[model samples]
Target: MDFYQADPTLENYWRGVILFGRNVASYKFALAHALYEVDKSGSDLVTLEELAVPFSRHLCQHLLHAPKQITSRGSQFLDTCVQFNNGELTQDTLTETTIRLGFNNVIDAFHNVNAGEIEKRFFLDERKTHKGIRITDNFYQLSERQQYQNLAFETNARWNLVEQAWAMGVSRNLVAIEFDEQEKLLFSHVNTRRVNITSCRDSLNGYQKGRCFYCFKPISLVPADTELADVDHFIPWKARDEVANINGVWNLVLSCQCCNRGKAGKSSHLPSRKLLQRLHIRNEYFIQSKLPLHETIVNQTGTQPAQRIDFLESNWARAKNNILFHIWEPKAEGEATF
Candidate 1:
């Protein structure tokens, strides 16, 4: 489904931008975090300097832990952020640099995803008329959402995952990030040590676009939500002995608790061919996003689309023959919406 057509809600539109949008640099996520921080003041109109404070601060904070924020070889704006983080540059200098170079493309490109603009505009670019952006009613309503904090954490998680991917490089040996199902994180093995990358739930939720993988209902990473999201193995993980790369990102998905473990949960059963096809579509989003998971999926599955499909089907056939005796289907489902 067209991402915006799936749920048209403000929350989904925000997720579409964060999850599916292109990521040549981490500026968009930093800008998104800055928006949330600024929104707390309840100001509809924000000057470039006011927005620059949080925006530069966020990029600086993240840079301290993970150095690579952009996919390119270097960025002058990011270099300025690093200097601020290192105490080599003053906060005033950082703010001025942010205003001059930070908003160059993100301000205009924030709402775009899947080569289209989302239906809702969270902020209006008043920079041409004024010196800043005007927060739209859509943004205020989004700020008031019950899942607002979850959105903030999701952006951080996506940023962390992308940078980690860039730092780890695309080699199979260095970039083999494994999921710790118990801790619900994706971690990589560096030399002899293991480094946890980011929350698996927060990272995958974007590709799923905040909806259940099976029934297509809204889901959340927030601890307080009654119907919390679950990190699920699309093909049952229990049959690992029969399937290669069973725990690969290509096989994992974020599912609603009900569709994951409730009365209609797939449990150890194999999903129907229809759901397998749905899984294929979801995995393609990972490929299209060109994030770290894109390389991981390609290495585990195949380099081409047809080969990836064959990989899933071959494993499904093997698991069907070995472990699962039942074909599980969701009790309730809507049109496929990934």
Candidate 2:
């Protein structure tokens, strides 16, 4: 049977849960319930404080049941989270805690849960000290890693440019292009005449069909889009100066004009590289395995001989891992409020 056939009405329910659970107050309760379900086989045995550690434990356990390819990519994230928890909690080690909880088995514990119905949740304590500091530190570490990667790409591109210059025995004059507040080309050596911002905006809208790449929000009504769809550096420009050219396609992305304005010249608030790697693995597994299973279950149930319980179990395990990585987690406060 296809995974979705087991639970037909899951996608809509999951989307709702994800939307509502992002609220700080609701998130704590939702996370507590998830933790209790994993730990005590019911949602009645755990207190709020006990929920925190087990949430991490459940994440690790679910990861263990994922496909080998996915699990391989998750090693870095697991080690990083363990280290972070160890250092942060100090007295209690994550390794000891995970082992004590008897979650070392690679069993498919989440097979019964509807994969599409699971939503990412978080816990927040208003009175907790160092909360902001921890969140900020995590964001900074990931940002630095992304910046480093961008710089590396820039260096390679600069080297290529130098090679081209040497072969030509002369170089064309470097053009300095500057965009105005409206994203119109205000200054350019190639064309001294000012480029119309409205034209650029219309061009971008046509390209992206008026949708923001990050949040998938419609940008047609956004006032900033009237000037131009903010051309964003996928790999930030500040840290990658070598290839920070005025015309690099790989570095650019279509962003919501509002988000572009707010996030101008700013880095993204991504999770650690370790965490990102894990998320990448989970994402791939979902696309390769679980998504297919969901589609198959929805369309071809009882038509295929290979549709065994074991097959479904494996696929569900893969989906469960994807959910645990929090790949669909909403933005934190003040990040993507457009």
Candidate 3:
């Protein structure tokens, strides 16, 4: 479904889905970023080599699911990315290898953009014809438009959503696993007994005082069985594959069914800075409990309380900077005015 279809909001349109359909002319954030970030040389064209690097990097960072690679290739690629970021490897060298993994998919994705059914008049490929893959001047121009930017944002939001689901699955090593039919081993020995999302009602709700994280509404736990508090990841666990221990107590919080469902649909929102602050206090409450969760907090951050605060703050900042993740605007959701 289209991002707008799922969440009819200005922010949803601004941060679009990975829409690529036959003659649908839909928008894609990856394509827009790749086009705009590429060389602005006199000609409206750049070689696949030029575009390939940025495309690979962008996809790697923004990829929602495991890129569907052979055994260990995905983790290998991630390790290389870390090395590259840490200056152990050069960008050019990393790009050379990484392009092979997803460049072809990028080409097909661009094809989807051109052939999709959103604004045919703004189709990127219509402006130019070239033997090799190259972005056109029209693409650059279109990407700058307000409508284009909104769609781009929507596309990114979808990508973020997929990435979140992917992380949740991967943290449990459930990637590519088929439970009903054939069992596809993604990580290693599948533990049929150990569940990643264990029952957190007893712990999380008690810690939260049975209040929803987002709405702060009182949640029912007993025979009421209505609006039960859900143990939700405070940080959303979108990039758990990249960041370890996201499933830890430090990131766990309670949300009522309504707020939980609302947040579940909001693929593009980060809790505001103030909410992050609140989460810190909440986690600090956990530390005072002196339970296993207390150790979790100490281990994730440090022995020093100030360091723990710094850890939470820096992590939220990291999230904001890393994905350009924005705070949710409940007011922004509605019929598309543009």
RMSD (Cα, Å) for all candidates, in order, is 2.7, 25.7, 18.2
lDDT value, candidate 3, whole model: 0.48
Candidate 1 lDDT over residue span 1-338, tens digit each: 35557557788789878877888888999999989888556678888989999998898898999898887898899999988887899999999999999999999999888777878999999998889999988988888876576798789888887888777775444367679989989887777888898888888877776678888777888877786788988888788899877778888988888888877687778888888898888888777766677877887888999999999999999889887558888865555664
Candidate 2 lDDT over residue span 205-279, tens digit each: 322223454544554523433533466643334334332232332123456555555633123422233322322
Clashes per candidate (backbone, < 3 Å):
0, 1, 21
Which of the numbered candidates is closest to the native, going by highest lDDT?
A: 1
- Give residue 207's error in model 3 in angstroms: 1.5
lDDT values, one for every candidate: 0.83, 0.31, 0.48
Ranking by TM-score: 1, 3, 2
Worst 10 residues of 3 by lDDT: 177-186
What lDDT score is found at residue 79 in candidate 1? 92
